[model samples]
Target: MAFKRVSLIVAVAENGVIGKDNDLIWYLPRDLKYFKDTTAGHTVIMGRKNWDSIPLKYRPLKGRDNVVITRDQSFQADGAIVVHSLNEALEIAKKAGDEEPFIIGGGQIYKIALEQNLIDRMHITRVHEEFDGNTFFPQFDENKWKLVSKEDHAPDHRHEYSFSFCIWDKIDDSQ
Candidate 1:
């Protein structure tokens, strides 16, 4: 099966940090809701660490096909499919007919997906504040992507910082 689109979904701080100590640095309920709504009926692929970081109680997120990528052959995640590589995960998503499978990640998985040019779009929740963290989202070539849409939101009761929901599409070089 051929897949038409592979996208990345992430919340990044102003300083490019995405997580710290294997967990998210912020608790933005709005962002969480946005994530759940956007990926509800699709396939979500993440690295093992990212999968592990999810609070145990709400894991294997309902209403979506979950694929966990890991190098460890013995790794098993209840209620989720475990694969050996990004390619394998992609194949599963493709077979599932999810044209826009979301690569929801840890730093390393994001870096690999970006480097492999496996991503066709990005759903970014851009937090307006800088954060100190050990895990950072990988830098990509801005020239290769174009902003498609953006919605800025002010800080609310459930959020501490203002943020923007930005969608970017990879520019087709053949165009």
Candidate 2:
């Protein structure tokens, strides 16, 4: 079966941490806006906790298909589709035809997607500093991917730290 375009979206610190205690460690309004603008019309698949981490007011992210992956078959997220596995989520995304599915994640989902070779590209926000966190972004072989684009942002009144928005495209050896 042909899979639709899939990408992983995340923000990681210098130490590779993404979150702590189920919440983001930093407050970067621009990064959040970048995320919203990029994933606005696409399908976004995330782990259950990641879905929950969104404030109750923003439970279901607007303007995109929100697929929450969880083990609980009875789990329900308002305005979001709850699925059991990554494959199921991808299948749903494929049915959408045009919009690519982006993995907006917690650590485990990121690791699984990378390991399963289910990602075609990556949108990573590289934070310039580190913070204490229990969750981390997974490590992967950098040689397997190519950096296609990047935009650096300097810290300002709204953004606490300097960061870079990086886009990586997966290299297909079969080509």
Candidate 3:
């Protein structure tokens, strides 16, 4: 048996904006493809509102199990596993397998996971611009994390957007 850890995969603007009106703040085909390819076979956890925000056709992600995190006692979706807290989400993730599941989300899920130390890895896209956004990712002390890799994606014909992909891991203070 192996240990389970929480991982988040997200793309945001340089200004830390994540979403607006329950939808993504920006669109870049390369970034979207990176997200889909990286998370294809993993489980994905998100808050109920985020689930609802996705279109009906895209609600249940293809080739990946969808786990909806909700505080309501009666929350359920057609093909989603509903969990009340991050603990329960992690428990279910462990049963799924050792490989960390993707914590795909809006703002609330990121906030809670950051608080519980549930996040082990982050695959982030720093889009080189900013816009008005309703949701924001929580800010953390940089001393607690170290960047492992970065890739600069040139603006493509399909998407006139420039972004940098970055991966980071949490530093163990006890070590």
Ten-residue region with minimum lDDT total, candidate 3: 1-10
lDDT of 2 by residue, 1-175 (tens): 3555689899999999999999999999999999999999888999999999999998799999999999998999999989999999988888876357899999999999999999999999999998999999999888999999999999998888999999999999997
Q: For candidate 1, lDDT tens digit of each residue in 1-175?
A: 6777888999999999999999889989989999999988899999999999998998898999999999999999999999999999999998898878999998999999999999899999999999999999999888999999999999988788999999999999996
lDDT score at residue 53, model 1, on the 0-100 scale: 92
For candidate 1, the TM-score is 0.97
Ranking by TM-score: 1, 2, 3
Query: Per lDDT, what order, best first?
Result: 1, 2, 3
Model 3 per-residue lDDT at 49: 83
Candidate 3's TM-score: 0.93
lDDT of each: 0.93, 0.92, 0.84
Error of 2 at 80 (Å): 0.8
Q: Which stretch of 10 consecutive residues in model 2 shows the poorest summed lDDT?
A: 1-10
How well does candidate 1 score on lDDT at residue 112? Answer: 96
lDDT of 3 by residue, 1-175 (tens): 4455568988888788988888886779888899889889888888898899888998798888888999899877988889998778767877888477889886889988888887888898888888789888888677898999999987877766789999989988896
* Model 1 ranges off by over 4 Å: none
Candidate 2, after superposition: displacement of residue 166 in Å? 0.4
Which of candidates 1 and 2 reaches a greater TM-score?
1
